[model samples]
Target: MDLLGNGPHVRQARRDAYREEDSLRTRRDRFKGFTNITTGSKGEGLTCCFKSDSDVMRVIDNVMCVEDGVNCNNISREITFMILNFRYYYHGHCKLRLGRRDQFIHPFVRRALWNDEYLSKE
Candidate 1:
């Protein structure tokens, strides 16, 4: 069954509707200082039903992540930096190491630190 109707026009209309909804969500998140990056079927405007779930990744601009050997001269001092350690590999994710101990780290991230070095994937 064609949930978005049979014609090309109908499919385009459905996609436009989804895009509008996603745009509104992005604007709302931006007001709270977070950038919402949508992923999955809903993000791609392939959602044919309201029951479909939207995968969203929220990024805070105040936090930055960079790999080792990357230049940090252009980064703002006010932002928190977390080093991405590709050396310590997990199943599908790279390890995140605390860049500087002197800077302020969020309580949640602080609690997740392993051995006062890398952040736990848990």
Candidate 2:
């Protein structure tokens, strides 16, 4: 099975593997950059009114930046989960859960991160 260099399929497979690896590497780098900015190590100028490393700050930005036709309310659920995960990691429990989806998402987002419930079972 000297397929490594002997067949077009093998060559295509190798190309596909290389492309996948490259894509993953690019995504990893992009995430690393985001992590740096969100943690306040970079892009500090992008945010105001909240601590740079606050996950709530990132969630607010992301909610505000969504494209038209995409419902920010719907996406807020996911963002709530992200914030909750961050809280659970840094602290021991999530003390926040988002309000009713029918209400605008930004108000809840604007509330202090530590003082709200964005992912409560209710």
lDDT of 1: 0.66
Q: Which candidate wins on TM-score?
A: 1
Task: Give the winner by lDDT.
Answer: 1
Q: Where does candidate 1 stray beyond 4 Å? A: 1-23, 29-31, 88-91, 106-108, 111-122
The Cα RMSD in angstroms, rounded to one decimal, for candidate 1 relative to the true structure is 4.8
Over 33-80, each residue of candidate 1 has an lDDT whose tens digit, in order, gives 666666676555555646577676777657888988888767666667
List the pairs of residues colliding in candidate 1.
Answer: none
TM-score of 2: 0.23
Judged by lDDT against the true structure, how good is candidate 2?
A: 0.39
lDDT of 2 at 5: 41
lDDT of 2 by residue, 1-122 (tens): 34434355554564454445545654666644321122231222233324255321222233333222334445554343222223334555443333334434444455544344542422
| Residues forming the 10-long window of minimal summed lDDT in candidate 2 | 35-44
Each candidate's TM vs. the true structure? 0.63, 0.23
Which window of ten consecutive residues has the lowest lDDT sum in model 1? 113-122
